[model samples]
Target chain A: QQPVQSPQAVILREGEDAVINCSSSKALYSVHWYRQKHGEAPVFLMILLKGGEQKGHDKISASFNEKKQQSSLYLTASQLSYSGTYFCGSRKTGANSKLTFGKGITLSVRP
Target chain B: EAGVVQSPRYKIIEKKQPVAFWCNPISGHNTLYWYLQNLGQGPELLIRYENEEAVDDSQLPKDRFSAERLKGVDSTLKIQPAELGDSAVYLCASSATGELFFGEGSRLTVL
Candidate 1:
């Protein structure tokens, strides 16, 4: 099943902060975050494994709540280069590497 | 390392026509996947291959769509008698373990 994302879209200015949330009805073994620019392929940003782990990439980071079956991506001090659609993929038990992505959240970072 | 590679960044076809997209996964990657993304939506997996064997294809529309990864390195997805609904971006991804890397994707426009 596809994961659900909140705040379908958001606009931010440089040095601002934004968060994208993803929730799944089923349990998740891992959660991954990706960003896609217009007309470009989605790029892997970070992956949060089970056990309520967290990972970071420069100013972007994510946290996974395994018990809640949810994840959230945090973009701090957003930059114009961060303008893109963010997608979260979840891997459920018994399904290794079979990711179901959430409807992307478009983030527009202005100058 | 070179990421997944896809050709014909864009294609235009009419209904009932045939179209094919190609992808070359990252060197030494053992898993490859194909996904379809409609405008303003997340990607949906179409097929996945381990080595040269397809491990999951339950989501692929075999009636009109076919995919193959002959050498376990490069792959191809073909759509015969393409329908208007096939107008979307076809994404190819590869993974070494858990995190997946995507290509630039091939966008199809059907008239």
Candidate 2:
């Protein structure tokens, strides 16, 4: 099953902050985040494993809550380059585990 | 190192025609995935290959869609008698662990 993402779209001014949330009905072993610019491939952002680790890079951060079966991506001091579609892929534990992705959220950062 | 490579970047064909897309994964990667993404939507997994074995392909339209990862290095996805609804971007990704490296994608337009 595909994960569900909140806030289908968001618009932000440069330096603003935004959060995209992903939730799954099943227990997740890991949550992976990626961002895709127009006409470009999706680039890996970060991965949060089951231990509830919060990872960040520069102004981008993410948190995964195993108990809640959810993950959130945080973008602080958003830049123009941040404008793109964000997708969250979740992998469930157990045999035959496969990664499933959410429908995605579009983030637009303006100057 | 070169990321996942896919070609051609764009293709157009009439309905009922056959179309094929190719992908070469990152060196030493053991997993390859094919996904379909509609405009304004996130990628949906069509198939996943662990080495040369297809571990998951339940989401693929078996009647008209087929895929193969030959020698566990390169992959090809083909659609026979393509329909208008098949017009979408085909993305190929490879992974050594779980974080994926994606190609630019092959955009298919069925007219």
Candidate 3:
């Protein structure tokens, strides 16, 4: 099942902060985040395992609540290049489980 | 290392036709995935493969959609008798250690 994301769209000025949320009805094994620019491939941001172990790049931070089946992405001091559509995908069961993604949140950072 | 590669960046066809998209995941990545992304939406899982075997294809519409991963390196997704509703972008992604790397994606426009 697909997750649910809030704030379908958000616009922020440079140096501002924004938060995007994702929650799934089914239990989650892991939550993954990605960002995609217009006409470009989706780039990996981070992944949080059920036990809270996280692996990802810098410039962005995220938290996963295994008990609640929810996750949040934090963009602090947003930069112009941070503008993009953010997607949250979650796996419900095992390593072989497919990732189901939410509708996505559109973020725009203006100078 | 090269990222996932997909062919036919764009395709336009009339309804009731057939289309196929190809993908080559990064070398050494044992897991591959095909996703369908609609305009202004996140990518949804169509199928998943592990090595040369299909591990998950529950979301795929078997009536008109079929996929295969040969040698666990290259994969193809085909759609027959396409409908206007099938107009969307097909994304190919690969993962190892739980992180996904996506390709440029193939955009299909069924007129």
Query: Which is the leading candidate under DockQ?
Result: 3
lDDT of 1 by residue, B19-110 (tens): 99999999999899999999999999999999899998999999999999998999999999999999999999998877889999999999
Candidate 2 ranges with C-alpha deviation above 4 Å: A94-96
Task: Kindly list the per-residue Cα lDDT of model 3 for residues A23-68, writing each as its tens digit.
Answer: 9988998898999999999999988889865443556789888878
Q: Is candidate 2 or candidate 3 better by DockQ?
A: 3
Judged by lDDT relative to the true structure, which candidate is superior, 1 or 2? 2
Candidate 1, superposed: residue stretches over 4 Å from native? none
State every prediction's TM-score relative to the real structure. Answer: 0.97, 0.97, 0.95
> What TM-score should be assigned to candidate 1?
0.97
The list of candidate 3 runs beyond 4 A from truth reads: A53-57
Ranking by DockQ: 3, 1, 2
> In candidate 3, residue B104 scores what lDDT?
98
Q: Per-residue lDDT for A49-79 in model 1, tens only?
A: 8899888889998999988998999999999
Model 1, residue B51: distance off in Å is 0.8
**lDDT values of the candidates?**
0.92, 0.93, 0.91
